[model samples]
Target: MNEERIIELEIRQAYQEDLLQALNSVVAEQQKQIGKLEETCKLLHDKLKSLARAEPSPGLADERPPHY
Candidate 1:
Protein backbone atom coordinates (compact mmCIF):
# COMPACT_ATOMS: atom_id res chain seq x y z
CA MET A 1 0.00 0.00 0.00
CA ASN A 2 1.03 3.66 -0.47
CA GLU A 3 2.15 5.91 2.39
CA GLU A 4 -0.91 8.13 2.01
CA ARG A 5 -3.22 5.12 2.42
CA ILE A 6 -1.40 4.04 5.54
CA ILE A 7 -1.69 7.51 7.06
CA GLU A 8 -5.42 7.65 6.30
CA LEU A 9 -5.96 4.30 7.93
CA GLU A 10 -4.07 5.42 11.01
CA ILE A 11 -6.14 8.58 11.32
CA ARG A 12 -9.37 6.66 10.97
CA GLN A 13 -8.27 4.20 13.64
CA ALA A 14 -7.44 7.04 16.02
CA TYR A 15 -10.87 8.62 15.55
CA GLN A 16 -12.56 5.28 16.16
CA GLU A 17 -10.62 4.81 19.39
CA ASP A 18 -11.63 8.26 20.63
CA LEU A 19 -15.27 7.61 19.78
CA LEU A 20 -15.17 4.29 21.64
CA GLN A 21 -13.74 5.95 24.74
CA ALA A 22 -16.42 8.63 24.73
CA LEU A 23 -19.16 6.05 24.41
CA ASN A 24 -17.71 4.09 27.31
CA SER A 25 -17.71 7.20 29.51
CA VAL A 26 -21.33 7.90 28.68
CA VAL A 27 -22.34 4.32 29.46
CA ALA A 28 -20.53 4.44 32.79
CA GLU A 29 -22.40 7.59 33.78
CA GLN A 30 -25.71 6.04 32.78
CA GLN A 31 -24.94 3.01 34.91
CA LYS A 32 -24.32 5.21 37.91
CA GLN A 33 -27.61 7.04 37.40
CA ILE A 34 -29.42 3.73 37.06
CA GLY A 35 -27.95 2.51 40.30
CA LYS A 36 -29.16 5.62 42.11
CA LEU A 37 -32.64 5.24 40.63
CA GLU A 38 -32.84 1.63 41.73
CA GLU A 39 -31.90 2.55 45.26
CA THR A 40 -34.52 5.31 45.35
CA CYS A 41 -37.17 2.91 44.09
CA LYS A 42 -36.32 0.39 46.76
CA LEU A 43 -36.54 3.02 49.49
CA LEU A 44 -39.88 4.25 48.22
CA HIS A 45 -41.19 0.72 48.05
CA ASP A 46 -40.13 0.00 51.59
CA LYS A 47 -41.66 3.24 52.83
CA LEU A 48 -44.96 2.43 51.16
CA LYS A 49 -44.94 -1.06 52.64
CA SER A 50 -44.32 0.28 56.10
CA LEU A 51 -47.08 2.85 55.74
CA ALA A 52 -49.52 0.20 54.56
CA ARG A 53 -48.72 -2.00 57.55
CA ALA A 54 -49.09 0.85 60.01
CA GLU A 55 -52.49 2.10 58.80
CA PRO A 56 -55.63 0.23 59.77
CA SER A 57 -58.08 -0.75 57.08
CA PRO A 58 -61.29 1.32 56.91
CA GLY A 59 -63.48 -1.84 56.74
CA LEU A 60 -66.00 -0.10 54.56
CA ALA A 61 -67.76 -3.39 53.87
CA ASP A 62 -68.95 -3.63 57.49
CA GLU A 63 -70.17 -0.04 57.78
CA ARG A 64 -72.71 2.21 56.10
CA PRO A 65 -72.27 5.82 55.01
CA PRO A 66 -74.12 8.68 56.80
CA HIS A 67 -76.29 9.19 53.74
CA TYR A 68 -77.70 5.67 54.07
Candidate 2:
Protein backbone atom coordinates (compact mmCIF):
# COMPACT_ATOMS: atom_id res chain seq x y z
CA MET A 1 0.00 0.00 0.00
CA ASN A 2 1.12 3.57 -0.62
CA GLU A 3 2.00 5.85 2.30
CA GLU A 4 -0.90 8.19 1.49
CA ARG A 5 -3.36 5.31 1.48
CA ILE A 6 -2.10 4.10 4.86
CA ILE A 7 -2.41 7.58 6.36
CA GLU A 8 -5.93 7.98 5.07
CA LEU A 9 -6.97 4.64 6.54
CA GLU A 10 -5.50 5.58 9.94
CA ILE A 11 -7.33 8.89 9.93
CA ARG A 12 -10.59 7.21 9.12
CA GLN A 13 -10.11 4.72 11.93
CA ALA A 14 -9.41 7.48 14.41
CA TYR A 15 -12.55 9.32 13.33
CA GLN A 16 -14.60 6.15 13.75
CA GLU A 17 -13.24 5.63 17.26
CA ASP A 18 -14.03 9.18 18.26
CA LEU A 19 -17.57 8.87 16.90
CA LEU A 20 -18.18 5.70 18.85
CA GLN A 21 -16.91 7.29 22.07
CA ALA A 22 -19.18 10.30 21.65
CA LEU A 23 -22.16 8.07 20.97
CA ASN A 24 -21.50 6.08 24.11
CA SER A 25 -21.25 9.23 26.19
CA VAL A 26 -24.53 10.49 24.78
CA VAL A 27 -26.23 7.19 25.61
CA ALA A 28 -24.93 7.27 29.17
CA GLU A 29 -26.22 10.78 29.68
CA GLN A 30 -29.58 9.83 28.23
CA GLN A 31 -29.86 6.86 30.56
CA LYS A 32 -29.18 9.08 33.56
CA GLN A 33 -31.75 11.61 32.44
CA ILE A 34 -34.29 8.86 31.91
CA GLY A 35 -33.76 7.65 35.47
CA LYS A 36 -34.30 11.11 36.84
CA LEU A 37 -37.43 11.54 34.75
CA GLU A 38 -38.82 8.24 36.00
CA GLU A 39 -38.25 9.25 39.63
CA THR A 40 -39.88 12.61 39.05
CA CYS A 41 -42.87 10.94 37.45
CA LYS A 42 -43.26 8.60 40.37
CA LEU A 43 -43.07 11.45 42.85
CA LEU A 44 -45.66 13.41 40.89
CA HIS A 45 -47.88 10.36 40.78
CA ASP A 46 -47.65 9.94 44.55
CA LYS A 47 -48.40 13.58 45.20
CA LEU A 48 -51.42 13.50 42.93
CA LYS A 49 -52.66 10.34 44.63
CA SER A 50 -52.35 11.97 48.06
CA LEU A 51 -54.14 15.09 46.91
CA ALA A 52 -56.93 12.99 45.47
CA ARG A 53 -57.37 11.09 48.73
CA ALA A 54 -57.15 14.10 51.02
CA GLU A 55 -60.29 15.99 52.08
CA PRO A 56 -60.58 19.70 51.30
CA SER A 57 -60.77 22.31 54.02
CA PRO A 58 -64.21 23.40 55.11
CA GLY A 59 -65.91 26.22 53.14
CA LEU A 60 -63.83 25.49 50.00
CA ALA A 61 -67.18 25.25 48.29
CA ASP A 62 -67.88 28.89 49.17
CA GLU A 63 -65.09 30.21 46.92
CA ARG A 64 -66.48 32.30 44.08
CA PRO A 65 -65.43 32.14 40.45
CA PRO A 66 -64.09 35.22 38.68
CA HIS A 67 -67.41 35.41 36.85
CA TYR A 68 -69.14 36.08 40.16
Candidate 3:
Protein backbone atom coordinates (compact mmCIF):
# COMPACT_ATOMS: atom_id res chain seq x y z
CA MET A 1 0.00 0.00 0.00
CA ASN A 2 2.78 2.41 0.90
CA GLU A 3 4.57 1.72 -2.39
CA GLU A 4 1.46 2.42 -4.34
CA ARG A 5 0.97 5.70 -2.52
CA ILE A 6 4.54 6.72 -3.32
CA ILE A 7 4.05 5.98 -6.97
CA GLU A 8 0.91 8.03 -7.06
CA LEU A 9 2.66 10.95 -5.42
CA GLU A 10 5.48 10.79 -7.93
CA ILE A 11 3.04 10.89 -10.82
CA ARG A 12 1.32 13.91 -9.36
CA GLN A 13 4.61 15.69 -8.92
CA ALA A 14 5.60 15.05 -12.52
CA TYR A 15 2.35 16.46 -13.80
CA GLN A 16 2.70 19.51 -11.59
CA GLU A 17 6.20 20.16 -12.87
CA ASP A 18 5.03 19.94 -16.48
CA LEU A 19 2.19 22.41 -15.77
CA LEU A 20 4.57 24.82 -14.12
CA GLN A 21 6.88 24.76 -17.10
CA ALA A 22 4.03 25.43 -19.53
CA LEU A 23 2.78 28.34 -17.46
CA ASN A 24 6.25 29.83 -17.28
CA SER A 25 6.58 29.66 -21.06
CA VAL A 26 3.23 31.43 -21.51
CA VAL A 27 4.23 34.20 -19.12
CA ALA A 28 7.52 34.70 -20.93
CA GLU A 29 5.79 34.98 -24.29
CA GLN A 30 3.32 37.52 -22.93
CA GLN A 31 6.15 39.62 -21.55
CA LYS A 32 7.87 39.63 -24.93
CA GLN A 33 4.66 40.76 -26.63
CA ILE A 34 4.14 43.46 -24.05
CA GLY A 35 7.63 44.80 -24.66
CA LYS A 36 6.99 44.94 -28.40
CA LEU A 37 3.71 46.79 -27.88
CA GLU A 38 5.38 49.30 -25.61
CA GLU A 39 8.04 50.02 -28.21
CA THR A 40 5.39 50.53 -30.90
CA CYS A 41 3.44 52.92 -28.68
CA LYS A 42 6.55 54.97 -27.94
CA LEU A 43 7.43 55.25 -31.62
CA LEU A 44 3.90 56.32 -32.53
CA HIS A 45 3.90 58.91 -29.76
CA ASP A 46 7.14 60.43 -30.98
CA LYS A 47 5.89 60.54 -34.56
CA LEU A 48 2.69 62.31 -33.45
CA LYS A 49 4.64 64.87 -31.46
CA SER A 50 6.89 65.62 -34.43
CA LEU A 51 3.87 65.97 -36.72
CA ALA A 52 2.17 68.32 -34.27
CA ARG A 53 5.26 70.47 -34.25
CA ALA A 54 5.37 70.63 -38.05
CA GLU A 55 1.74 71.73 -38.40
CA PRO A 56 0.53 75.27 -37.83
CA SER A 57 -1.13 76.19 -34.53
CA PRO A 58 -4.91 76.18 -34.13
CA GLY A 59 -5.69 79.87 -34.71
CA LEU A 60 -3.26 80.41 -37.56
CA ALA A 61 -5.20 78.36 -40.08
CA ASP A 62 -8.56 80.01 -39.22
CA GLU A 63 -7.67 83.52 -40.26
CA ARG A 64 -9.88 85.50 -42.68
CA PRO A 65 -9.38 84.63 -46.35
CA PRO A 66 -7.49 87.08 -48.55
CA HIS A 67 -10.81 87.97 -50.24
CA TYR A 68 -11.92 89.73 -47.02
Candidate 4:
Protein backbone atom coordinates (compact mmCIF):
# COMPACT_ATOMS: atom_id res chain seq x y z
CA MET A 1 0.00 0.00 0.00
CA ASN A 2 2.78 2.39 0.90
CA GLU A 3 4.51 1.74 -2.43
CA GLU A 4 1.33 2.42 -4.33
CA ARG A 5 0.87 5.66 -2.46
CA ILE A 6 4.40 6.69 -3.31
CA ILE A 7 3.81 5.99 -6.97
CA GLU A 8 0.65 8.01 -6.98
CA LEU A 9 2.43 10.91 -5.32
CA GLU A 10 5.17 10.77 -7.92
CA ILE A 11 2.66 10.86 -10.74
CA ARG A 12 0.92 13.83 -9.21
CA GLN A 13 4.20 15.66 -8.80
CA ALA A 14 5.13 15.06 -12.42
CA TYR A 15 1.82 16.39 -13.64
CA GLN A 16 2.14 19.42 -11.40
CA GLU A 17 5.58 20.14 -12.74
CA ASP A 18 4.39 19.95 -16.32
CA LEU A 19 1.44 22.21 -15.55
CA LEU A 20 3.70 24.74 -13.88
CA GLN A 21 6.04 24.87 -16.88
CA ALA A 22 3.15 25.31 -19.28
CA LEU A 23 1.73 28.14 -17.20
CA ASN A 24 5.12 29.85 -17.08
CA SER A 25 5.46 29.72 -20.86
CA VAL A 26 1.98 31.16 -21.37
CA VAL A 27 2.70 34.01 -18.95
CA ALA A 28 5.98 34.83 -20.67
CA GLU A 29 4.32 34.99 -24.08
CA GLN A 30 1.52 37.21 -22.74
CA GLN A 31 4.08 39.56 -21.21
CA LYS A 32 5.92 39.86 -24.53
CA GLN A 33 2.65 40.61 -26.35
CA ILE A 34 1.72 43.18 -23.74
CA GLY A 35 5.05 44.91 -24.19
CA LYS A 36 4.57 45.05 -27.95
CA LEU A 37 1.05 46.43 -27.60
CA GLU A 38 2.26 49.10 -25.19
CA GLU A 39 4.95 50.19 -27.65
CA THR A 40 2.43 50.39 -30.49
CA CYS A 41 0.05 52.43 -28.36
CA LYS A 42 2.81 54.88 -27.48
CA LEU A 43 3.79 55.33 -31.12
CA LEU A 44 0.18 55.92 -32.19
CA HIS A 45 -0.29 58.43 -29.39
CA ASP A 46 2.81 60.35 -30.43
CA LYS A 47 1.75 60.42 -34.08
CA LEU A 48 -1.70 61.70 -33.12
CA LYS A 49 -0.19 64.41 -30.96
CA SER A 50 2.10 65.51 -33.79
CA LEU A 51 -0.76 65.61 -36.26
CA ALA A 52 -2.86 67.63 -33.84
CA ARG A 53 -0.05 70.12 -33.45
CA ALA A 54 0.30 70.49 -37.25
CA GLU A 55 -3.43 71.07 -37.81
CA PRO A 56 -5.21 74.41 -37.56
CA SER A 57 -7.14 75.13 -34.39
CA PRO A 58 -10.94 74.97 -34.31
CA GLY A 59 -12.25 78.05 -36.21
CA LEU A 60 -13.76 79.14 -39.53
CA ALA A 61 -11.54 76.72 -41.41
CA ASP A 62 -13.11 73.74 -39.57
CA GLU A 63 -16.74 74.71 -39.77
CA ARG A 64 -19.43 72.13 -40.48
CA PRO A 65 -20.93 71.80 -43.94
CA PRO A 66 -24.13 73.66 -44.85
CA HIS A 67 -25.92 70.29 -45.13
CA TYR A 68 -25.49 69.85 -41.40
TM per prediction: 0.80, 0.73, 0.79, 0.84
Better of 2 and 4 by lDDT: 4
Candidate 4 per-residue lDDT over residues 1-68, each given as its tens digit: 99999999999999999999999999999999999999999999999999989995788768898999
The residue pairs that clash in candidate 1, if any, are: none
Candidate 2 lDDT, 1-68, residue by residue in tens: 69999999999999999999999999999999999999999999999889877965457678787788
lDDT of 1 by residue, 1-68 (tens): 69999999999999999999999999999999999999999999999999889996678788888998
In angstroms, how far off is 47's CA in candidate 1?
0.3
How far residue 28's Cα lies from its native spot in candidate 3, in Å, is 1.0
Using TM-score as the yardstick, the better of models 1 and 2 is 1
Q: How are the candidates ranked when ordered by TM-score, highest leading?
A: 4, 1, 3, 2
Where model 3 places Cα greater than 4 Å from the true spot, the runs are 57-68
Please, what are the lDDT tens digits per residue for candidate 3 over residues 1-68? 99999999999999999999999999999999999999999999999999989995678678888889
After superposition, candidate 1 runs with Cα above 4 Å error: 57-68
After superposition, candidate 2 runs with Cα above 4 Å error? 56-64
